[model samples]
Target: MWRRRAPLATACAAGEASLFVNGIDPGYSGDTAVYGALSLVTRADSILVQEVCDYGNYDDFDFTGTSMGFGLTRDDEPPPLFLPGVIISMFGGLVRNIAGHVGVELDEMRQRIEPWYTDERIECAMATIEPGQLAAVRFAAVGVCGGVPVITVEHVTRLTAAAAPHWPYPPDGHIGVHRVVVEGEPRVEVNTHVSHPVFDPTDAGCISTAARAVNTIDWVCRAPSGLFAVADIPPTELIRGVMW
Candidate 1:
């Protein structure tokens, strides 16, 4: 069957830039298309646009529900945004040209998300309780798109407490927070937003101090796992995958 390749090409062109399909039909049976697609990486900052980006009929083996794995290619390291699905609405949005940049509008592009985790309001799911000798805290995770709330993570738990050795004074330091629980153990939940991209090294020191103060509170506890892995809303430099 001579399947349609225009749909795939269209989807690719609607994004950050346009992709030349080299006049190949995606329906052609075999892995040749896959190789041809992979070979496009030599170009500068290009992605391997999957013509039929959806999961195959094999439902059990198909990871389409949680991760599309669309085979995005970049010249540098990839973006840190963990996208589990494709943005269906993006196909209908207005396409903009940001100077030399192509694809969708800047504001509209920010709205695209694949959902790494569900959204749960930390205000409701989490609480800090200082019980005399010990301190207990809980946090909630929410999936956000373009600054808007979408899903909530009510089941998972992730918590981090600022550590000692005091990060550093200038721009040459990295601070780590403790999880308050043993590795591979169930834990309490905690929710808090992190302000990343400190821009200046001096400012980073102040933030690190603030983090340490939070952890020093008697006994601050948190969830052992979940979305609280890398803090929250990190800078583009700190992120590795395609951020919604």
Candidate 2:
């Protein structure tokens, strides 16, 4: 069910970059979905210095790519019956057919726009960030419904830290004593989770290229609900889990 297609890239004079991608969910009746996205922010003024170092350079941009498509559900075959069973089967088949058509059109659009963005242009568009500042990147997804496309979702993540609170006990009545204590900044971890309509781990070439482009910050693509566990698990358990 996988298609041999490359990501479609585009940039605007206003310093915006874009990438359109297509992936198929083989497990779900080979249903294909398209993900059209704006380019990730990469300027030194937009990303944290520590995060930039994590990627080895200020240009190493991390992004949460998203896509949207119909939530196709696979229906179970029903017993052979009269009009009721026939109607159910027909409706299910019709829905799948419509989804398939949308997928094809999306793929065609991606292919048509491929030439607009070249390798050199894409590299030049990725900006860099400075140290100690929080990253200023944003994430959004394009969705198609009834043959029309629209912006369906948007997200943003921020990194922050606060001083640890202190507690003191009162002096005993027998002895007069006073004590005060101050604590350093409390360490906090920031996590950004993004969900896409479809993902294919087998796309080694695409994944490798993206990882390198972002300077390899351990990007993960998992099931829609899998991200919830990231907050509960330790760093060692933050393993990559993909749902196709």
Worst 10 residues of 1 by lDDT: 21-30
Cα displacement (angstroms), candidate 2, residue 129, comes to: 5.8
Which lDDT values do the candidates have, in the order given? 0.23, 0.21
Task: For candidate 1, give the lDDT of residue 244.
Answer: 48
lDDT of 2: 0.21
Model 1 spans > 4 angstroms off: 1-19, 22-94, 97-108, 112-244
Give the range where candidate 2 is weakest over 10 consecutive residues by summed lDDT.
109-118
Clashes of 2: 11
Q: Write model 1 residue lDDT over 1-244, tens digit each, in one string.
A: 0133456545544643332211111111112222233234332222112221111111321242113221222222322323222232222111111111223123323223321211222111122212121111122223333554322211111211221112111121222111111111222211122225744322343454354334322221222212221112122322232234
lDDT of 1 at 218: 24
